[model samples]
Target: MGVQFGSFDSICETAALVICSLVGTAQGIEPSCYSRNVEVGGTIIFQPSTSFVHIVAIIMTAIMIFHIRSKYTAVGRKEIVMFFYMYIVIELLAMFLDSNIIPTANSSYPWFAAIYTGLVAAAYCCLLINGFVGFQFAEDGTPLSLWFMRIACLVVFGVSFFISIATFKGFAGFSYSKPIGLWIIYILWPIICAAVYVVSQLVLVFRTLEDRWPLGDIIFGAAFYTVGNVLLFAFSVTICDAIKHYIDGLFFFTLCMLLSVMMVYKYWDSITREDLEFSVGSKAAVWEVKDPLLSTGLDYSEEDTVSNYHGGGVAPSLVGGVSGQQLYQKGGMGGRGYPPSDRY
Candidate 1:
């Protein structure tokens, strides 16, 4: 399924941003004033490349939540959302503590630093779990309910949480500056790996046209996110850290813009899950339509057989819940819209 686990909703992102803003203000989390040297009276306001990853984190989370609740609307979706929500909390809270927003050197809890690392690890685990969930969705907008998938998600979350706590408390915490655990989390077995996996799965589906999955806004967003993070990671590995602090906000801001825009103008994603039942030729010769106001995924494949309900005055749009008369056949050549009446 395209949208996180199909559409990007922004409610949670908005709420989290407001809460973080208030907290940052109260705690005096001074955003770096990169514009002070360039702009008049810039010292009084925030910079263009803001150091507020939490703001965008929540917004992205909100879109995932909205997609789960509205389109998927399944028990599995609820479970995935719950984990995803936890992931958001961990990341936002870490940003609040780890940043110079508040000095951690003389903090009451000597172990707080480890806690921050744990949060990062756990959050990545949640992200990977959601990625796995995305693969389970059937064409009909429900997950496969596969036990192995469910078990894998649970096991990873559980193990990741414990390992994160352990790594933080152990000697790894002090040497975190050149940390192996952190390196593994970000490099060898990076969180972005999940995004890569998703894109790979999508590519496979497109080529075979055997799976009915929506290539909704989430795919594009994930692709964008993966690219940004990959570039950032590569640069961090090779380059100096002096400029990263000042410009890191740009990467986060760019991701937020891409995702937010896709959420608003979701043309391809507008088509309902019903559309996935219809056939889309193939990746090489794929033909997709655009109707911006009607943004949601119309998942399809070359081998699909679409069946629609054609009755009453309520005509179904090619992409459902839209206002138009495109005269699409309710059901294709070999399909029937309704069952025969049991008059006998």
Candidate 2:
């Protein structure tokens, strides 16, 4: 949740920065006043306070790569692979755009903004795919709520893609700024994704509790992610434009670090621990005894057996032997014959 929130806040901060810059530019005022200026080899660039966002993004990409490589199962491995490839492609695109490697009409440098926007759309698409696969493989296997979330992500990805394409095609036009559409992409999409993640976590928590499984790791991890994202959102909304970018970057970087650490710690024992076993219902009983004692003998009738035992006139002793003295003292057994030795 923290990561989601942080990412959201970071995106919001980026949006706000871009909007402020656009508004300042429109008003014939310098947007650099709200940004930090840096000189690289005599060339000037306005470095937004949110530059740290890129740094954090790099760290997150690394962590995701590690996660993908470390994961063991086929599902986990596939998830990691998808995430890794998608993130790497997106990151590379972003770098190319940021570095201005592509040439533009006004400057000999490349139009990195168009490339960056396209990469963002691609990244979101990958995220959507990952979420879909994850929901499918979940223990419940496609619950209604999960299906809804998956569809919502897909719709968001589609919208983002169209917007990116428009921005890329109209790169030279004044109205081609993708930042305007990004307002929706960065602000709304993160919130939706975070909500889905939280709901999924809740489901897992309840399921684990029902099964009497340890939930400490899942609970803690989810709580961290959730809280981080919430803080990022709140900070982005409240901070002044001058400082919002820096704050946003800080929040994102911190969240990524924390999540990476927690995930590593939580899964460290995965190799040594027993594989989790999930069953739909109750287990069958297993009897160990080879033979069980029964009161009835084979081919015997209860009534007949009782009558035979009584008709023999066998005097009941203290321990199932004949005892004439005791039988006589109690009452004659209807003058039944008994040997002298039976007196004892």
Candidate 3:
């Protein structure tokens, strides 16, 4: 049942109370979605389905990294590629956390979870920053822009890490029972970042680009992201029960998240183009062919004049003043061109 805010005297007070309740309520601690029956002296595998999804996400992220790197001339390549790297890290940590490979009782769980939380925050922060690259607020792909993004992500990661560790370890008066800080860092922060990124990208597309195809990519990404989170936070338990514990929201959530990331890549690739002259890929060569007979009003330098071909023996009119058509006439021994030696 949902909490009734109607009883509260004012909206501000109701908001305050809700915020207070969020403390020590690390809601990520949910029931295991599914587990496989594996017994080698009886050890049940936990959330194997979700773990498999994590593995797939990792592979997909690596593929995205390769593809993004290949676009050497694309704007914001370095900055956005960093997001996928962090994502890979997050998924690796999640595989261990969700699968219970790192047991909850393990003393390192809180530390690892804190690191994971921080990385997730950093990744989202990176995405939010990247959304503005098209605005040329600073030159994209420059060291200045790259470092700015790196430092911003680092600061966000550090703050998120502190909050998470404080909550998990019950330090700095952060109670394990009231993990509001973690809830904000882990859940609310990502949603805020995503909203900002989407808004910024929409502005970029509408205000800057002539082609609006990226809008579709943005829409698809937002849809996948929305569906993934909804499945995870709203209907995980219900789906878990409905599926007879075979799989749950986490699986679909992971899949949708992957699709969302792919859309991010698609949108970026759509907006950015390679300078083909400097591109690493092979390009067809086009040679210019000029017919000497048809060439007229051609200006030749002193070194290229027909005088050099005739060894100063031709008349002054036909020497340096010769037209391209006269230079190719049958005057020399070969009768095909002016000079038999082919100097002309």
- How does each model score on TM-score? 0.45, 0.46, 0.75
Each model's backbone clash number:
11, 11, 6
Model 3 local distance difference test score: 0.75
**lDDT value, candidate 2, whole model:** 0.43
lDDT by residue for model 2 over 108-178, one digit each (tens)? 22234434444454444444444334334553223543454445545655666556444434443323333
lDDT (0-100) at residue 245 of candidate 3?
A: 69
Error of 2 at 241 (Å): 8.9
Where does model 2 exceed 4 Å of error? 1-35, 45-60, 70-74, 91-115, 121-125, 128-159, 165-182, 208-344
Candidate 2 weakest ten by summed lDDT: 23-32
**Model 1 Cα RMSD, 1 decimal:** 21.1
TM for candidate 1 is: 0.45
For model 3, the stretches where C-alpha displacement exceeds 4 angstroms are 3-43, 282-344
> Over the stretch 102-145, how does candidate 3's per-residue lDDT look in tens digits?
76666787788788879999999999989888898999889999
True-structure RMSD, every candidate: 21.1, 14.2, 9.5
Where's the lowest-lDDT run of ten residues in candidate 3?
Answer: 9-18
lDDT of predicted model 1: 0.42
